[model samples]
Target: MKAGGGDGGSSVSDEEWERFLRASLEGVPDAPEEPSARDRAAAARRPPERAADTAWRAYTPPRRRSRKGWYVAGFVASVALLAVAFAPGGVTGLFGDDARGADAAPLAPESVAPTAPPDAGPEAVRPTLAEPFKGSPAARWADGPAGITVPEARATGWMDRAEVARALRLSRDFLVASNLEPGVLRGERPAGAIALINPRQRDVQDYLAAAFRSPGEANDPVLLFSRFDPAQARLVGDVVKTRGRLTYAEGEKGAVRVTADVTFVYPIAPAGGGDAVVRTIVRREVVMSWDDPAKVITEPGTFSLVSYRADMTNAGCGPATGRLIPSFGGGGGGTASGPAVDPYDRSTSMDERMGAAGDEECGTATRS
Candidate 1:
């Protein structure tokens, strides 16, 4: 964050220089005669002088020169001191000090790149179809469902290794269906994913259906599935950058639970088409559990979706949470109301945020 040009050299006015000279010589005695080799020897031979003696008394004062002559010599000495102080490898040069006397070499102006102010967010860069994810962390992420990786399955306390593997696979299918499927991303009902949920969870099924039929804050389909209004924006390319992992563990009542935590990056351009592209981030975490199919009234491939959470960043805030609405360059209207959150930040668990029931606010984003 170094900034701005050097301050340039300093200058001393006649009045100021004179004042400096007077102050420096305040208690200094008149110039003493240079001791000859014999006189120096005699002085060296003498006993040690008192440490408390005034500095001016250290020198044997001789007959003082005329006032004008003394002033001329003192001025010349002061000028030499100034020359050394400003020279390369001198006080100013050694410290990278920018200030110097006017005649000193001008400091090479620092080639500092301009930076945004602390309160200001990253500069907005228009995205192109060739580089839809430019200027974003998503650029390095895996494209599409390839980024959603399932961890190595291991037997939980209640389920065998084979059952745990099935649970992991089921969770992965649900994620791909809900977030990355071409039909689902186009605002179509996520039939494949919905079907995967346990048929016995009637309440969950009803809620999912109502979210799409009658959209509102309580049941926003966009929170679960990534979709954009076809009339507003089109996919920039076929790829959607993504990254996350799925883990399996034992859940209540001897069931194996697979949790998927992932972030999806979607790049879109205006539906009419052009080079402008914008990215919308969707982070979803879903928990799916498997039990004895005979005991839980479950099918072979389906699992009970115990719980889930999702957060959409760069998606504008308002009553339009039903579907993702990508804000194009300088387009879309909505005011953010809280602290900016970095969607790429996966260091902390999303569970902490989603669990806080009262913490939802339409804030800003550090970047798209």
Candidate 2:
């Protein structure tokens, strides 16, 4: 009982209890003061070094994507740019200071039109065949003939005197080579005659063909001259001679008109008679048109005979002479005058004296 009462009495008072709680609080020291909401907001507002570092890291540029691929792409772009810059019209815009820009107005058509080139002048006059053949033996022979007289060749405008003379010479050569040449009597065709006349001239070709047909029963002049039928009539001697003189005048449209007086002398024998010498005189007129120099369709120095005439005479070949007689009558010979009448002036008369003489020598048909 005494122990129980003493234990009860030992219980602490309220003040003592209060002092104990205060002492415990003081001894523990107040828990550190918690930051207020305002303090926390201020702290957050301050820019911290760590926060700056974090921002810098976040904002840092990403490493360039595959520098190798970028370099390749850049190189490809540069090549393409160079190709475009160096093209024809492209170079003008890129390097020319005066070149118009893309936004500039286009040039007028008149300003950009191309200019024409200057024309070349006319061609020079060329030399003719006579220049090279002057003073030749053929010329001397040509002058030696003693039949009808021919007018001298005359050049006018672009006409060449030499060419006229050459044409005459060629005509003479064709006749002589075709009829008088020794081998031609054996049915040989005359290549020279064929070459002289233009085949395109139908009339002239036909005339020449008829004249040069093969020797037959017909008494054609060509056959008579060739003496192809020796049994009936033949040239007696091997000696056959020819001589001629010529005159040339200009004709309409730049054509050349030629007149030739020629003589052929030979000996002949009839079928039942003795040999006798024969002299034949002839006059020929021909018109020659020029050959195109730039073309080979016709031969150079060859001509087309637009007009032609022939007059003939023979001696020692008449009925009384007992020789092969030519049917054509012999006429008086003509005299030659120097130059040609002016072809440009149609009103100008031809030399009446010479023309009259030609008429007497040949006939009205031989008049030019």
Q: Please state every model's RMSD to the true fold in angstroms.
A: 37.8, 61.2
For model 1 the TM-score comes to 0.63
Highest lDDT: give the candidate number: 1
Kindly provide the TM-score of model 2 when superposed on the true structure, using C-alpha atoms.
0.37
State residue 182's C-alpha deviation in candidate 1, in Å: 0.7
Shift of residue 149 alpha carbon in model 1, Å? 2.1
Tens digit of per-residue lDDT, candidate 1, span 17-98? 3354344333223322211111101111111212221322222211100000000011101111121111111111111112
Instruction: Give the CA lDDT, 0 to 100, for residue 273 in model 2.
Output: 50
- Give the C-alpha miss distance for residue 18 in model 1, angstroms: 97
Candidate 2: clashing pairs of residues: 151-247, 313-330, 332-361
Give the TM-scores of the predictions, in the order they appear. 0.63, 0.37
Consecutive 10-residue window with the lowest summed lDDT within model 2:
65-74
